[model samples]
Target: MAQLIDSLRADGICIIVVTHDMDLVKALDARLVYLIPDRPGAGKVSGGPVQSPDGPDGSRPVLLPVAAMDQRDEPPRRSSRSAYIASINPAFRLIGAFLTALPLLISLDWVSATVALVLELFLLMAAGFTPLRIVRSAWPIFLGAPGSALAIILYGKAGGATYWQWGMIHVTQRSLDLALATALRILAIGIPAIITVLGIDATDLADAFSQVLHLPERFVYGGLAGLRLFSVLRDDWSALSASRRSRGLGDENRFKAFFPQAFALLVLSIRRSTTLATAMEARGFGGTEERTHARVSDVGPRDYVYLLICLAVPVAALATAALTGRISYFGN
Candidate 1:
């Protein structure tokens, strides 16, 4: 591994190594970049060559000295109640999201879609999410729903009473009904997925996928590893932007500066990925035999309840629409 890193360095390639292995860092003579969390969505970075305390042959990474931020004095408080959406097995939650979304996508009537939307809102609240949190996380749906509805209202198949007509655009009672149904359907499908998936831990999801869903362990772990880099990328972007501002480049057009910074981020991501892949290889990640999980993932009664809700909401929505004579099958 040391020889590989040395060779890469010799080839004029820069490597960014992210690891706790001090020996590996020493072998590569890599500078340390310390990320100290000073606040939510913000942090401080201290970077320099760190000298090992054990006379340059230490087996542990040298801890960088970071000044205590005043904000760190009070830690964030934890919620007393466990999040309902996060408690269910991730596999079950995923399957439930799929089941709940499928019907909303297929239903072509306002009544069924409205029922599904109401049920989805109830589920979101049941999952312990506040209305503000739901809107914050699923704002795209809120915006896109109205936009989609307007598009459908203007361009959807026109029938029933004609309200307006223009070049390549028509509005009618049937089209307006379909538009409302489409908007409600978007909310129904999107809200549940966003609410359930927002707080899921990547590691837990990986475990559930590998153990409960019988997915390929290598693929699951690799994907989880990749997901871990998302936060790092965000931090890198913040740091990069800050550095640019400090260099008096902040006044430049952001659109012009975006490409260079994005390219730099892409380079950093590739280097990190290479290092991660090497570390995984060293840990025998892609061995032919199956590996055991440290923690077992299981589906229980709560998971069953989630699945039941997923199944029930769509059925009840369709049933209500049928009874009200508002059921409109797709394509007819």
Candidate 2:
């Protein structure tokens, strides 16, 4: 393939080599200049490789995948932050994130939760996500965690001395402690989970599902198709909203206008899904023959190291909680 590409370049035939293979570019020592057509209808794609005029001897290849791509950077520059993340296998990242949070469920004591959160915070910083970046990417986790904590604070079965009482809401020492533990636990579980999946490519995850996890190809590819079209839904919603505004419905109550807009979006989704299904069937995806993947997604030494850290964090948290006499599983 390298020889063929070099021969083609020599023949003055410039072509777009679509790939997500960073190693291929590095191995060929070829620089890529990404181009997105200046057309609104040109969907913002995430990964495509455009060979630069500079051939193999030019310079080291820098990965700059050109696309706004799912509300990410437009003509995205490969930041160091994303580079660290993109190195891991998507399947292992998914597994590790869950593993790191799972052992925290051994006990819901504030000690364990706080210790785990602190360790996770350090790890997140080490992974090139600054405090600000983590929050920006995982704001939903932050918002939901506090809301959950607030509910616990308000009505979490008052125990020990009460601090304040107003109607059904009682602020007690035990509730305060429980709320703190709940908040910390949510952050501990949610932050790393969010960060692991920050820049995950759907194709890579699909490949991982098929190759690493041995999932059915039909299910994996169908999932990939769904993820790809999810961005289209955003575009469809925006277009629908704009169309409504043009028809002078923009000033109407948002709550009242929501149902019609939702119904329209659902109709559009069904039409698109039908077309996509037809296309997939035409491509032989409906056949019983086993399909082969063009790329591989396997765990490496780094992945093992990451898995170790995931195991260690929760163990250390629980151990520390036990030392403080705060750890109790299932209220035992």
Candidate 3:
């Protein structure tokens, strides 16, 4: 991401990173951009960067000043809202679990997971993401859940009365129960995963994964390289789609044309990945035996709390059901 940003900026592209992390914003540039709210349009958004002096270490973190909309161009209020949220701190694992499963979560019936997922969504919204942005970020889970749900239903082999059979396929009372359980479990698992990930930034994720997992540096750096290419490929795919639309090719039946286009995208991605891997190898990225973390990634107190909650919920739910004599695993 740094490389990409640097490259873009070097080419005079207007790159703006709206971020809460002082460390990251400092890394990006000394000059900062501020978005101030309009008054009559109060909370109506307007923004621009006014460069301030750098930090003491000659890093010279430039502060951007904004003026009030109504005042005689008096420098706008520098609210501490952003600082407070950023200062609260977050746990790495909580971020990871959330990112990994959030999409599948949002796809699940909200009634079951609403209490948990809604809280996560609230946190993410407070972190400055819109609902649509959060949903889009989690969109991939929509594709992943059906395959998983299908696998559970097909293979779970519910031990009960058979209702229908075709070849080896069976629709038994047991199977139905298994399917429902499987679907619910998937939803429960997915929601928090999505929320955590969507809330955490990409750099934070990379740091957590590398530091917590103790992943091989080669694999980590190589994967990061590949990820950079993947992002480029995503952009390229969008451009290609727009081009296709301009060429009047967007009206084609989705299933038929989508596959070919998707295949083309896969090929493009693979090609980019190949190039990236080769470049990394040439740069001796895999040569290092010992590695050090550039940034701290700790599983803090909050992560443990979140994990405990994750473990406790189903346990409490199951116990309640058992006490009520409704805890039959088979629902017989």
Candidate 4:
């Protein structure tokens, strides 16, 4: 339907829709017109209401908030998106993300972690990201860093100028320093890892695994098919929840409902998996015949350059900390 409308619009045909499907309305960017009803006391009924080309629905369309009137007021959605990062081979992207995080994992020093974070921020910007976009993808890591830091601040190695103490909790200078380093390290390792892996296609990754890395196809394709079913299972879960609610079973405590809901979902999932396996077997998934991939997977110069940059970030960070005599090994 959308394609038909687009083709018609391309040939200068006016596309007018009179349905109440808000999804379709927004999808086609259709203008809405309604017959204005007469009020109780203020006014009399008028002739057929003619909608003006621009002000047909007035400044704001009187509709539900979900059916937005003006598009301009809505903010662009924040996303961890980077064409450059996604263009790299999936295998190499994962390898590079691992390498980028490896060095910071070795030492617990604020200087190195801070330097790594700063350098990674610059790289993240080069990958076409803003602060908000990174945060959008990594808010869990952001929240988790402070939580870990709080733990370290309270109960970590407590020496060198004590500040506060309460039973097992001890606040000290060393503890504070360690907490800061831990937080910085978590951020330095997490943000780039999350962003780089944001847009990797599952099929592309499976292709890379099978074609480039030569992993077992049975496992690789099985994982890929399982990943594809995630959305289907999610929809099934929603439907189950609605069914339960309509049957008056969802009014119970969530904890009490969780077991039965989970059991039903599990049963449905197993049935779907059985059907999927049967279909795949019919299509020769686990057969003896050799298989081919639709997309080619290989690395190039750009991937090498990306890997080098990933290596350089931690190298520079650790070097700075080492030169400044602040680099501290784990558990030392």
Which of 3 and 4 is the better model by TM-score? 4
Candidate 3: residue 101 Cα off by (Å)? 9.2
The parts of candidate 2 lying over 4 Å away from their true place are 1-83, 234-268, 330-332
**Per-residue lDDT tens digits of candidate 2, residues 196-265?**
8777777878888888888877778887898888988888999999999999999999999999999999
Please say which candidate is ahead in lDDT: 3 or 4: 4
Model 3, 156-180: lDDT tens digits are: 5756787777776777776666565
Off by over 4 Å in 4: 1-80, 234-261
TM per candidate comes to 0.64, 0.65, 0.42, 0.67
How many clashes (backbone atoms < 3 Å, residues ≥3 apart in a chain or on different chains) does model 2 have? 0
Local distance difference test values of all predictions, in order: 0.78, 0.79, 0.56, 0.82
Where does model 3 exceed 4 Å of error? Answer: 1-187, 234-271, 282-284, 330-332
Quote the positional error of residue 244 for candidate 3 in Å: 13
lDDT of 3: 0.56
- Write the residue-wise lDDT of candidate 1 on 196-288 in tens digits: 666666777888898899987778887889987777888999998998899998889999999999998999889988898888887778788
Residue 171 alpha-carbon offset, candidate 2, angstroms:
1.4
The window of 10 residues in a row where model 1 has the poorest summed lDDT is 72-81
- Superposed on all Cα atoms, model 2 deviates from the true structure by an RMSD in Å of 12.9
